[model samples]
Target: MNKIEIIARRILGWKLNRWDRWYDFEKEQFIPVSEFQPEENIEHAMLIVERLKELGFSYKTNGTSGACFGDVCETGETLAQAITNAAYSVADNSSIDEGWL
Candidate 1:
């Protein structure tokens, strides 16, 4: 893994600022809500999911050809809860609490 990934593994996870608040594991950095999905492609979604997985997050969602809706966790909570927390943090521009990771 890379430095950021290493950082990510060390209780230093990130939550993207994007709509989904997708965390970047490789960089252990947040992307911000603006970078989410203007196009909303599966490739991008999967990319985000991959990063989340590195953070030990998991998800499973059905698709109608190419979309999904599922969970992201290992944090002992629902993905929605995680996202809400993320959104709140983003709204507040607060520092990341890797401790929660």
Candidate 2:
């Protein structure tokens, strides 16, 4: 496996599956949120957020009442796009190439 896949599988504990789904490490099987715990889902999401931060991404909240979101440093990008770019960076060991943000 490439470094990206290795890091994703070993550190993030995720495996891409068909139908836009991912394997849940805690569950030991491939399934959707409908079969998982809410807390686990939050934990997994936080993991990605943390990783993105490590890759120089930033996040903000609406003063504890607004929705939480992330953005690229010095750029306006959606949280989802930031996360995807960061993951690709980790996998490829290269800087983010997406220009959306």
Candidate 3:
């Protein structure tokens, strides 16, 4: 699986269905990634924000399209991308904590 897929499964707790669509454990159904594209969809991107909060991180997005979570920070051309990058950072850190990185 790609990095995003890995993060979606390991960190975001999603599963890949037999049809190659993603199964959201919380939602309990397979959904198209495009419809739930966190990098472009605000509603889905909020999932990352919630996850950050659950991980005990306070975050903020500046007018310059930058997002910061403690020591992990990233900038993107758009707010969604910035949030998505933050998710990736969190997943990477989590992997390190679990000694899988």
Candidate 4:
């Protein structure tokens, strides 16, 4: 399977996902927005958000690195949701794409 890891753009508490066949992805409390430097300011974060948007992510904007969209994401929400949304946006392959987890 393809094991991939991308730094997060926001802080996430975590949740259990049992919809598809993908393995469980670890829950990270903090995720870096930029792929380059681990630390980031709002601008760098926005840049990461913009890149993520191009990759399939979306956001309304709240002057933050990552915007809240799905289910409010738990107070601060999750940075992974944006990418997950983008991934699912491509297609609903949850039932088959076991590697998505």
Best by lDDT: 3
**TM-score of each model, paired residue for residue:** 0.32, 0.35, 0.78, 0.31
Ranking by TM-score: 3, 2, 1, 4
Show model 1 residue runs off by greater than 4 Å.
Answer: 1-39, 65-101
Per-residue alpha-carbon lDDT of model 2 for 1-101, expressed as tens digits? 64334445544566767544568666677755344221224344456557555656565543222223343221114443334344444444445453321
As a TM-score, model 3 comes out at 0.78
lDDT of 3 at 25: 78
Candidate scoring better on lDDT of 1 and 4: 1
- Residue clash pairs of candidate 3: none
> Over the stretch 25-85, how does candidate 1's per-residue lDDT look in tens digits?
6566665444543133344345444544565554453323222213322221344333333
Relative to the true structure, candidate 2 reaches a TM of 0.35
Writing each residue's lDDT as its tens digit, candidate 3 over 3-62 gives 567557756677777545788777788877556677777677778788767767788889
lDDT of each: 0.38, 0.45, 0.72, 0.33
RMSD of 2: 8.7
Quality of model 4 by C-alpha lDDT:
0.33
**Best candidate, TM-score:** 3
lDDT for 6 (candidate 3): 59
Per-residue C-alpha lDDT of model 4 across residues 1-101, encoded as one tens digit per residue: 11112322122211323322222234333332223231223443344445445544355634323343332221123334343333333333344343322
Check candidate 2 and list the clashing pairs.
4-91
Give the TM-score comparing model 4 with the true structure, all chains together. Answer: 0.31
Q: What lDDT, from 0 to 1, does candidate 1 have?
A: 0.38
